[model samples]
Target chain A: MYIILFVKISDVGENTLIEIIQDLISSSESRPDFRRKENLILGIGDDAAVWKTESGLEISTTDTMVQGVHFSFAYSSWYDIGWRAMASNLSDIAAMGGAPLYALINIGLPIDTDVDNVKDLYKGILAVGDKYSVRIVGGDLVKSHIIFITIVIIGASSQNLMLRSEMKSGDVIAVTGSLGSSAAGLRVLSGALTNNSEMHKSIIDTHLRPTPRIIEGQILAENGIRAAMDISDGLVIDLNRLCNSSGVGAIIHTDKIPTDRRLKSDFSGEEILGWALSGGEDYELLFSGPESIVLSVIPMMPAGATIIGEVSGFNVGRVSVLDPENKPIKLNDKGWDHFKL
Target chain B: MYIILFVKISDVGENTLIEIIQDLISSSESRPDFRRKENLILGIGDDAAVWKTESGLEISTTDTMVQGVHFSFAYSSWYDIGWRAMASNLSDIAAMGGAPLYALINIGLPIDTDVDNVKDLYKGILAVGDKYSVRIVGGDLVKSHIIFITIVIIGASSQNLMLRSEMKSGDVIAVTGSLGSSAAGLRVLSGALTNNSEMHKSIIDTHLRPTPRIIEGQILAENGIRAAMDISDGLVIDLNRLCNSSGVGAIIHTDKIPTDRRLKSDFSGEEILGWALSGGEDYELLFSGPESIVLSVIPMMPAGATIIGEVSGFNVGRVSVLDPENKPIKLNDKGWDHFKL
Candidate 1:
């Protein structure tokens, strides 16, 4: 008899798992099917998969949200859950500067789940779909012990594609809308803070129902902005990913980070700053371009765009945050990792 | 204080749930985005969602499989689970006479799952992907209490499309390959039946790794056969669905059902017939067309197609199975339903 050993996902972490997957895919490159197709513009390592279509390019993306891990029903209604789920996928397409065309939803729920709740979930999904002209084509519903929703969105775009690997040294980095409110909203929902003000209610709504920046992303793409990504995993972490992909570094000023003024009225500066830095789920668009082009397109943005930093060549893949005094600030948390120990 | 009551999914049943969904989608028809899209050929109620492309048609479908609900690790390896999940989506595309092009795999696993197991799962997915020249484009990995996999597949087909609503009276119903082995193999794995013969191993393999009838579906489509669907639910139940879609009915002879010779040697006639009628997960293509066209295409099928029944005008949306002596046999069980009380 022989003994067997096992290695858990937490032991190697999410990054290593991704690396292993890449390696497996690369190793199969010799196979005819795995060979790179001419029409496939991008695959595996991007916000959305891209391929050439008749007139332009087709974009596809998928996102999965698990109950308890992603959201809690104690604070989020079924409609909110559905809206958030569809929003996440729509945001991915927005990050790529693509307009969503169709979506297929896959839901797994317990048999005893309320029928009205499930219908409300679809209502929320349709609400977002209608806003962006995305059609709900088909889906699969299965029985499960825990609840989960997975949405697959297909979209279209012109030749102008926003990509993370296109960031260049000396390009200015900017973000649309505000951040930290969604994370702060979670703090309120978790009962870490107590507030019943109208401002607090708005913050909670921001967390529950996010609007993907479709028009803003299109404006940037149409105006020649090439390097961009959505701020899903916080500014510092996602900026680091963009830098790593582009083989560069960045220096963002904390004072220049755009955040909700209403959040400042309720939370401490330190608490708000921390949330803004590493608080995930803020579906704002973070993009980089030349200073002249970036400044030219700012006025066209609906939610307003702010220049937060500039890309650099030194300390590749690292993001340095500076205070108003221009001194580097150290961060305690790295962003969200599904398999982090 | 205010009180609210909830109606559980089991309260209305799966059919009612689907009808409710249809009502919701139809009610939103006034919205500009919800209006009929010119390029969309088929929308909600089918094996796959279809839309027109420049040269042909594009097909998409999604399926979700939850651990314990769909499969258990006690008998199945992670590799088998991945293969089955991908196979389900592939079979959906095949049912439409489409050739799969790309796939996005979304996996939700417990944090403590073994890393090697996940790799084996990908290996299994890639094995099937490589067989059909399907490229694995992108996916999302999330944390969950229960392991689940959702795969979204995109495929393409020529103008000739096989649809469920195209069945006509006097059409001969035929199916590719044998059935009942998969359900029988599940019993062997569940320990309800004990067997150690070589044929038992083959039966177990059949249950573990099912091959979708892609070539057979395409041949039927190219040869002018129009109505078809995969035998995922039982033959009787799936046939009923075909009839419902076409506004017709069917009568299938139980004696004509093709079964594995090895399954017949080990299991009773009643047990084998029950599995064939409603065991589901067979992944065989059940199709109907003119008798001459169906017989003409039989020579092209790799697995040898068998004529099992014929479509009729009576008993719309109903399926009747007749015995060898011409007596009607009553079925105690319908096909698989996620929410059946």
Candidate 2:
């Protein structure tokens, strides 16, 4: 494939852009493992996409990423923007322990935006979506002052689906993988962290392309684990939501909270801890179940799954962090809120 | 519910605003006709909304409405905005001869936006959604420079579905309801139509709250009317698309074309004709099948159904309009193109 530099979207009208998208998607569907192609009764060039579904429960989630608000072209490419947007929605399906099946993408672009950029953006979205065998079935495109991508995914889950409100008082709270890498990666990309170490590059990659913990979520469901959620708006806030929904409280051990080793080495302890506690967009699985069951499940989970805390009856609906010396650490603020930010 | 007129979204924060939305939706769900409530395995507060589906084909479509570009709040109410957005997507499902089952709305709003306005917007959505027993199941919210609503709908169709590519030569082209009413309504709202009569009020209502031809489409599909499309763009352009997709052409008769009677009486013939031919957002179904079959099925359709033209083998992939004298009318352009517009 060759790049045609400087072809503005206005050069090709909406019809032509749609034709281009149709062409790209159709070609992609020609790949060997394109799963939904056979089940699709109607794909592109329809009023809507039609696909066959089995008798079961379906899970759905929609997410939107707006330019200047959720992302900026300055630090991220259109490819990154598309991939990250798809990943975020895929993570929601993961949080539900569902298998991603189909996606509908709505893209709003400025008239003068590059046509090549839009192609790359779809390629980026497809890159991540194809990894999970999620098919892009349908979408809409419109003109806007700001660019944004809204992805709606349809997934399927077993009747025994995981939910946030299923945690018990004696449940163990475990998180998959380390945290704060995305936050540190953001700092590196913004040049806030100027250190050009190899660790910084990995951290930057984490921010740019965080993997959705889909497999881990499905495994947890298969193992009879009930309560699960993806840590999106930072650990403290998301965990608070989990506890609140379950009518329970949490007691977290700071030492057991998985902090990125690279982040620990580069920043102060408080700074690293703050990033782990409050930095958003981590896309890691956080689940709670019985202590013995979770401990046994940990070894079977993806590497780096750590038991960080426990659901406690001491307080009905509050979360507290304990230092190594068993003193409760006070958190002035919970986590990042889009409006607060 | 009492109005809290001056409360801005920023005053409550995102979580609180979410709580308010959850409460609003839950209350709406409490109504007797809330058909999806019982079947919904999980709703709103979970990672994603879960629902039961049978073994069958599902239809899905996504549409986005951007502020200023799609509508002006100066003329359209928040309710109109929400209703129109959902109508646009519902029309897609209608085109596919599918029944609307669920809707997910992703809204991007400015922080300074009024809280009551957002509530009213959702109320508008639920108003329309409940009309067809479509439930508000899931969604995402984010901040944006200009507000936009992206609605994704999941619908279901029987094994036998209507499609644009199913048209054949010698088929009769028919449309549900009269055209140009929506364009006329827009003109009235924009002050382009100054004479405020009952006709104008009806036309304005048509524009603000166009209904999806769901029942009409189902009847067409049940009658084995193979080729179908919804007239979202003007008659000529959307018909051309149908013809192009089916590898056929059409000759629509000007005299037979169903222009809104009110529009025809109030405006110049040319202006009303232009709206019928090139103005958009009609939300009516245009379908084609064998002439005998279509004629037999006409009696079963809605009252306004009209036989406007016939699909032809000549010209294979173009659409033309014929005056009463059988002279071909020249089209400057087919219809609205979002980018070109």
What lDDT tens digits, residue by residue, belong to model 2 across residues A65-109?
Answer: 999988998899998998899999888888877888767778887
Q: Over 4 Å off in model 1, which ranges?
A: A1-5, A32-36, B1-5, B32-36
DockQ of 1: 0.70
* Global lDDT scores for all candidate models: 0.89, 0.76
In model 1, the Cα lDDT at residue A113 comes to 91
* Tens-place lDDT digits, model 2, residues B219-318: 8887888788888888998898788778899989988989877666778988888888878899988899988888888888774688999999989778
What TM-score does candidate 1 reach? 0.97
**What lDDT score goes with residue B220 in model 2?**
82
lDDT of 1 by residue, B84-177 (tens): 8888889998888888888999999889999999999998887877778788889999999899999999988867899999999989999999
DockQ for each numbered candidate: 0.70, 0.16
TM-score of chain A of 1: 0.97
Question: Could you list the CA RMSD of all candidates, in the order they appear?
Answer: 1.7, 15.4
Against the native chain B, each candidate's TM-score is 0.97, 0.83
